[model samples]
Target: MQSNLSSADAVERIVGFFEHLSAADLVRIGELYSADARFKDPFNEVRGIPAIQGIFRHMFTALEQPRFVVTGRVVQGDQCFLTWDFLFAFRSYHRGVTQTVRGASHLVLDADGRITLHRDYWDAAEELYEKLPVVGGLMRWLKRRANQ
Candidate 1:
């Protein structure tokens, strides 16, 4: 990872970094993001490399076999959009069943090819709450009531 990387190279590196991300790879987070990078997903919002690293660390702690499968990517200059499926099983419950959460990330890369802005978009209610054991029932009921 270099600061002079082209946008295409940067995007490719990001996709590959996520698809093969592991706890061991957490040490290389700075290779993908700038020191002052800002990251925001449905659950958390933080800036800087350490805070972003904490998010990934928490993911590994809270989920079982958490992984990302990138489906598509679009790049325009310094901005890139990636569509991906996040697959994981709950460590607390439903340990045998893997869940998929479809989402997209909007990223802005710095001149050095490191991510300066990372924002993830997804439906927390439909993708997450609807998959929980107890909350799933209530979420489904609410969805059906709203649809009707």
Candidate 2:
């Protein structure tokens, strides 16, 4: 966190960091999050900068060209909301087909402008499992059955 950083500045930095995130940028995770920051998404929940870095590292290993395109944002005091599209290609399955997962993040910044809480909202069944091979068929069938 930078000294005397404002809440808006912190939100901007966080958005940019995620938009251009890479494996090498993992080292800079502390710049955006507090040492004991908590992060939670659909599949995983963890605390601390090191744990956050591990999650991003696994993303790089699991996908090809994974990136986030921020579509919109809203900031209120120390809280921020960001809507984005996560684009990537499966390394083992549909290697060449790009997949997009639309999601939003809720971030709370500390006084020094470091994120203390990061929560991501996305539908894993519709965005992820429905794109897989065998699981995709099952997921689609299940969705149809539920809809009917």
Candidate 3:
């Protein structure tokens, strides 16, 4: 199988991956990630597809409704940079409190046209922590103290 993938093809495949995520399409993930894929984010450092899928499954179960909306994307060679807004209502926490968190993911596709490494960049304090009730108040208090 040919390994090299055009930048456009890579982006399309990635967009598809997010769009069809709720379907739990493991087959699509298999096509997009290498067998030894590594995914890293602020809260997770998961290896392999099973582990990655497990995370998504947990997310699906935890959130009332979770979805990724791609706001922008830039592709160069084997790398694709995507900016997205994640919208979800936390069923476990503030019921009906829907939040939209902006984030970026950098994906590196291997020679086999599969993602070898995926790293997400985002600020938990701004995107998540500040939205919590007690924690948000504490974070605001700390910020005020630091500025003084």
- Cα RMSD for candidates in order: 1.7, 1.6, 2.0
What residue pairs are clashing in model 3?
A: none
| Candidate 3 lDDT score relative to the true structure | 0.83
What ranges in model 2 sit over 4 Å off? 1-3
lDDT (10s digit) by residue, model 1, range 30-98: 999999999999999999999999999999999999999999999999999999999999997888699
Per-model lDDT: 0.94, 0.94, 0.83
TM per prediction: 0.96, 0.96, 0.89
**Candidate 3: residue 131 Cα off by (Å):** 1.2
Worst 10 residues of 2 by lDDT: 1-10
Please state the error at residue 48 of candidate 1 in Å: 0.4
Pitting candidate 2 against candidate 3, the one with the higher lDDT is 2
Q: What's the lDDT for residue 28 in model 1?
A: 98
- Candidates, ranked, lDDT: 1, 2, 3
Please, what are the lDDT tens digits per residue for candidate 2 over residues 1-148? 3458888888888888999999999999999999999999999999999999999999999999999999999999889999999999999897889999999999999999999999999999999999999999999999999999
Clashes of each: 1, 0, 0
